[model samples]
Target: MMFVIFISFTLSSITIINGVHFRGGMITWEPVSSVTNASPNITLLIHQRYAWSRSHIPCTQTNIFNRDLIGDYSFNPIVCLSSSTQCNSADYNSQRISSDVYCTDINLILGISSSSRSQSLSLRNNTKLVLAFKGNDSWLSLTYGSPAGEGWSLPVFIDLTLRPGIGINHSPTSTMPLRINIPIGILTSIEIPMSDNNVNDVIKCRWAKSAGTINGLSVDECAGACHSYTLPSTVQLRTFTKNRCQLNVTLPYVGYYIVALQIEDFSSNSSTIALSSVPLQFVLYGFDSYNTRTTCMTPPRITNMSPFPTSNGGNISVTVNGQYYGVIVAQTGCVNDTETYIANFITKSPSAMKTSSFPYAQNNTSQYSMELQWTPTIDQLGSTLTFCAIAIDVNDYSSDPFCVNFIVGPEITTTTDTTSTVTVTTTVTTSTLMIMTTSTTSTVVATTTATTSISTTETTTITTSQVVTAITSALSSDDGRILALGLGLGLPLILLISLLA
Candidate 1:
């Protein structure tokens, strides 16, 4: 086997090289703090930190780079297209090494964003840099810094004698190599794109409908026992499955009792989990009766909506209103990404005026919106707001919802006044969403936006004489029979009795 030894220097560094160790044609590092690791064939310390003009981030760069390590040692490592900056602020055990070959067997280890690995060294965009490290005869080691606060540690110089390279050489031993397992729906540390495993790969999830064979009382008798059905194996996280996902089972009886459903996912040890499908959601009623259509509309073209309101942190329902630009929606993301709301609301009122509520509700074809109102019973000030919408395709399958930005508005105040005031001011942000009404039969799309401000005031007062008159009128109106018959008039009574006869 042609052995290839690779060394990686994460950042520009200056390490005191104590000595070097070579065995079986393998060269390693040993740190004694006695010898300084020099850029090979040159006199400069292997690592040196430079200021992006001494302070600012976004990396420091130089138009001309001097690779000659023999001189001043002050070559602001030239920026290059393939440097480490491609990484988001994060903690990575990645590296860049000098093109030289003295201790080729050992690679330098630089940083790992314990939090946002890419955040550190977020230096100037497209800035060039070089990887440098420290070494010696006894062990191989290096230092690293994290942008997301695990900060810098007292140079974590690994012991090379332990097995592999420089200052500290720890052998890769044990069943798992620092394995970390995160639960399917747990709140995880915010991760950058490059450092995380696909959330789907980490979990297996599926939704199920209620299935029972018994009808009426018989199905009620079979309540505890439910037959299981699996979704198409391909149905996955962030992926929608709209196949006729019918839950087939034996029905003993059928009645007006409500059918219930609960969603589940696979756990670490292959266990089942009953997730919070709050109120045990009802996806489709009469689920057992295949091909059941329950008052479908133009699929609720949500014209516009405000973010869901809340009283506590991260506990708001996701709400948003907007016109149907060339899209259809199914649900909105609420509290957690999973706190979804079915976009298609079944209204008791006839489809608003002209549009039909078929295949999908098609009210005002272009723009429409609703205000998500809530009065938090608890902590109103600490609440956060989010607005997200899940669009559905013509195939009836839902799409990944996109979230909109939300600004928190102050609570509405009610004040008492004895006089009328015209300048009552309340700030309502006008949304970018606007729908244009045309005299023609077809719907028109409006993209223009305009800003307008408004203010208002109100007054209240009461008097005893008015209250007494109101009471008398209320009493008279309540006596409907006498009022209709004209209590004290002969002609009116005769006419009423004749009409009644």
Candidate 2:
């Protein structure tokens, strides 16, 4: 498989705003250049898996001041598909931005409607870039940010990033890269993290409880369907894929969940190599299986999210701020068992973030929590504008869900769209991972201390025959006997502490 690149000049960063026009990332970023010497790369850096590749088609560039979007500096425009139902045959040409919002991928106009699609564009400027996106068309618009969510407008943690499972240029063609637009409350922590595990890798997940009633729903404009996965319950969608290729299904609904991952042989039995094979790629810092001894895909880390109380008051525009983190390989889950970990957080959102996801090392322990501050509109604070915070990990519900309990406020009046800033004084934390992990949602934020405390683990001692044999064999030697005598139940405990920490 092969693909080509149409370089529009590298950018400092990538952001998707207004409606997938490509502003930067879910969170805002100024154009950055610390990494690439070139201008901005229009590839999405949300996840390295979705990062820029040499083969992807390059979208054009526009000055932050250019709003007309006139002229033919791009490839032939195409229709932006409205919905799967609207995947019409007509090749309607459309424009990306005009005067409302700052844009990126908009350089290449698409076919149909303007949507909140999740598309990535690699831009130049490595770091100092301030990326922002919103529907500024109407006064008091709707907005989301890097630490993306309904009211999450936070600065993304710079160091939380890690290498991706697949290279951005790995996609052979445009059709090959699975680009998707996340829905409201559906935070994308990882992208296309499909593992090439062999047969019988034994994928298993822990459950807080079983879902009594499972209802399926559909997103009117999306290609996938949503599931009303009633929770406090958990299960592995792919404990063991019946087929060898890959299990690529979309659950278009909201709730908690995580990748119950593994690899297997032809018999669908546990394989020795597991995820070590070449074709297999794991999320870097996510809640993935990076442990030495893998058990049923590492004990099913994280779970579905708890329902969030929401308000659509006046659709008033607001800005949110927060931070992010990631957990990598060579690291441990937030807790020893994924089930118990997720069970604590599941009460917040059926789809909450967890500590045990892929790409686990880097972000999981970084400075991801920041004070969440906001001022609601006079009309909203007392009415529609309600704010809350939840500290969620890569796996939405792998740990206890934190909240600042939301309260509606009256809509506040602003003098100009540029100055009046509403603040939500709260805290937020996010983590990333490695390998192919399927996690839940980003609910609230907790104190970094609370989160870090959870990272501490317990020590267990286990004695083996090797120890006794060494003891007996060494007894004959004075030094060996001394060493053997010193070795007791405490030895394993000490070793356990070192390993867990």
lDDT of 1: 0.21
Per-prediction TM-score:
0.19, 0.20
- Residues 294-341, candidate 1: write the lDDT tens digits: 222222223333233222112323122212122223332221222122
Question: Number of the top candidate by lDDT?
Answer: 2
What's model 2's overall lDDT? 0.22
- lDDT by residue for model 2 over 235-321, one digit each (tens)? 123333433232233333432222212112222245432211111111111232223232322222222112322231112233221
Every candidate's lDDT: 0.21, 0.22
Q: What's model 2's lDDT at 369?
A: 27
- Candidate 1's TM-score reads 0.19
